[model samples]
Target: MATSKSVLFVCLGNICRSPIAEAVFRKQATDKGVANDWRIDSAATSTYEIGNPPDHRGLACMKRHAVPMRHVARQVTQDDFQSYDYMLCMDESNLSDLNKKASKVKNCKAKVELLGSYDPQKVLIIRDPYYGSDQDFETVYEQCVRCCNAFLEANS
Candidate 1:
């Protein structure tokens, strides 16, 4: 029996990079027929966009790539640190915030790390696209695809 793997993609606001990574990873997993072997989700290190859907630009970017993305922004809770096997974040600030939160959870199980760390291209940051042009969103989507693919490949 194969044990299901679980991961939570996280960022500062949850409206941009994290959601894209989550969607991209999920789509790739489903395409490979292994989505059932994983529990996937996304969240935020901060409360900035809680309860809100992903940014419009991100939605548009996903549409352009034919990737499905549906997520409500949510802040990371101490419980998340226990629920997920891995909690991958967009950048250093999110990584720092998640690590700080994990420190408070006495039984934290999630491994907090940068989602960019999995990028084979060596891109270390998945920038926030809330203020940038649609091109910026495209760049984020491209990076997410690369990083998500590498992460999935490494685990498979």
Candidate 2:
């Protein structure tokens, strides 16, 4: 059996950007026949949206692309710091928040970094679309596809 690799996608509220990233990566990995090698999930940097479903706009966008996504908002935990192989976040604020949280954990082994760091186009941030229109969600989806594809290729 192949060894398992895990990733935790994170964002401000986990209702918008992170879920999109998680779904995109999952789909790409599945397409490449590596889905069984991954343990993918998404989380929030804050408790503001804990237990909430992903934002409706993001859900619609994922459906449009035929990328299956179903997730409840959850905050990053100490266990996550030790568990996931990579903890990829959306923006600078998320990077800072996750690094801060990881520092508080007893022994964090995950490589925490910006998901956009993998984007070939150098679009270094995936902005939240929570308060924006459907167009904003589409932008997030596009960026996620670009970044997630690069990330999967690099890691493969």
Candidate 3:
């Protein structure tokens, strides 16, 4: 393992799942008193929401859980393959995208995975709340929170 640990959360767009996962993990690390030991951020596979804030529903979901996240949307960069210890995608589609990119990098491919892999009981996508109702955001928040907590427990 690297001396310093950093994670990059990813999704199709940075507006929903990825940002929420970043916030959830940040909050989880803080709650575990390991915030100083790990770093977390998020990115999009596409540039649709580049430079934009997280989706409004996603923001509300984070606020509801007291997860503080202030992020400007950005597309995943090749440089991130070298920078982060882990690149966690919200689902299989995004994971496939990362895998293809990771394949081009020699050692970096070892560090990418699906966030659902961290789930203890069941695997699931960190569903997109963009086109859905507020409840969708809440559900995504719950899944992200669960995965984030599990990640901290296993890693720390």
Candidate 4:
């Protein structure tokens, strides 16, 4: 049997890109019959929108793509750096923030990197759609799908 892996998806806020990526990754793993082999979740670098559900546009985008997503917004914790096998963030800012936070935690095991780093299409940053239109939300979803699939492939 394969050993389980864990990942924490992170963004500026948990309401948009990260949640969509978390959902897309989870569903992809499930469809590939490997959901039980992973621990997947999402969080924000800051406390903004703590306890809030994903943005409405994100929710709708996931629904339209038939991907299920339900998560309360949360800030990344020091313990997260010690637990998750990977800390995948949406952009350069989040990468910097998480790296700074991880540096403060002894024995931080998570490999912090941009989620878009896994994108086969070469998109290196997953932009926030909070101020954009539905098309922006759809774009996030599409990017997550591509990146998540590639991540699963690489890890599997």
Candidate 5:
């Protein structure tokens, strides 16, 4: 492995889970005073929400919990596989999508991982909050916060 320290969080849409993971990871790193040690980003599996701001609910959820991060939705790019050290997915479907893309990559260096992989004792998938109630968003946010914090602990 390269000594590079960067991570790319991915999900079905950039509107929700991935952005939360990105922000959560960023926040955790900052809290640990290791924010300068890593570069973090997020992307979507599909183009549906590309060029759009993160979903309102996603933002509200973060705001409610006070996990600050703002980003526009974007689709995963070929260049990301080369630029990032790790590519983390929110769930199995997104992981499969990323894998399909990675299979076509030449000299791929990025390690694809599930966001929950950071949570050694409870490897649960981060649930999607797009179609749910505010309470659901809170639940998802809480889970991502925990997983993201764990990621920082293990990696930093």
Candidate 6:
């Protein structure tokens, strides 16, 4: 059996950007026939939207792109710090928050980084679309596609 590599995508609320990134990466991995080789999931930096479903705009965007997305918002856990191979976050604040959390987790092994770091287009931040228009959600989706593609290629 292939060894498993896990990644956890994180954002402020979990309802907008991170879920989209998780779904996009999953679909890309699946398309490359490596979906089973990796474990993919998403979480939030804050508990504000914990237990809530992804934002409707994000859901619509995923559906439009034919990316299957199903997730409940959850705060990043200490176990995530130790378990995931990578904890990829949306923006600078998320990167800082996750690093702070991971610092407190004994033996944490995950490499926390900005997901946009993988974008070939050099878009270094995936902005939150929570209060933005539907176009903003589409932009998030576009950035995820670029970043996730490069990420998969690098890891493969």
Say which prediction, candidate 1 or candidate 3, comes out ahead on TM-score: 1
The worst-scoring run of ten residues by lDDT in candidate 6 lies at 1-10
lDDT of 3 by residue, 1-156 (tens): 333788899999898999889988988888877888887889999989999999988888788877897999999988899889889898888988988888787557338888888887576677677899999998888888788888878888
Show the colliding residue pairs in model 4.
none
Error of 6 at 132 (Å): 0.5
Q: How well does each candidate superpose onto the true structure, as a TM-score?
A: 0.96, 0.97, 0.93, 0.97, 0.93, 0.97
> Which residue pairs clash in candidate 3?
none
> For candidate 6, what is the lDDT?
0.94
Candidate 5 ranges beyond 4 A from true positions = 1-4, 120-123
Greater TM-score among 4 and 5 belongs to 4
lDDT of 1 at 152: 95
RMSD of each: 1.3, 1.0, 2.1, 1.3, 2.4, 0.9
Per-residue error (Å), model 3, residue 89:
0.5
TM-score of structure candidate 5: 0.93
lDDT of 5 at 147: 81
> In candidate 2, what are the lDDT values of residues 38-74, reduced to their tens digit?
9999999999999999998899999999999999999
Please give the distance, in angstroms, between residue 82's alpha carbon in candidate 4 and its true position after superposition: 0.3
Stretches off by above 4 angstroms in model 3 are 1-3
Candidate 1 worst ten-residue window by lDDT: 1-10
Writing each residue's lDDT as its tens digit, candidate 6 over 21-114 gives 9999999999899999999999999999999999999999999988999999999999999889999999999999998898899999999999
Model 6 Cα shift for residue 149 (angstroms): 0.7
How high is the lDDT of residue 143 in model 4? 92
Error of 3 at 87 (Å): 0.7
lDDT (CA) per prediction: 0.91, 0.93, 0.85, 0.94, 0.85, 0.94
Between candidates 1 and 6, the one scoring higher on TM-score is 6
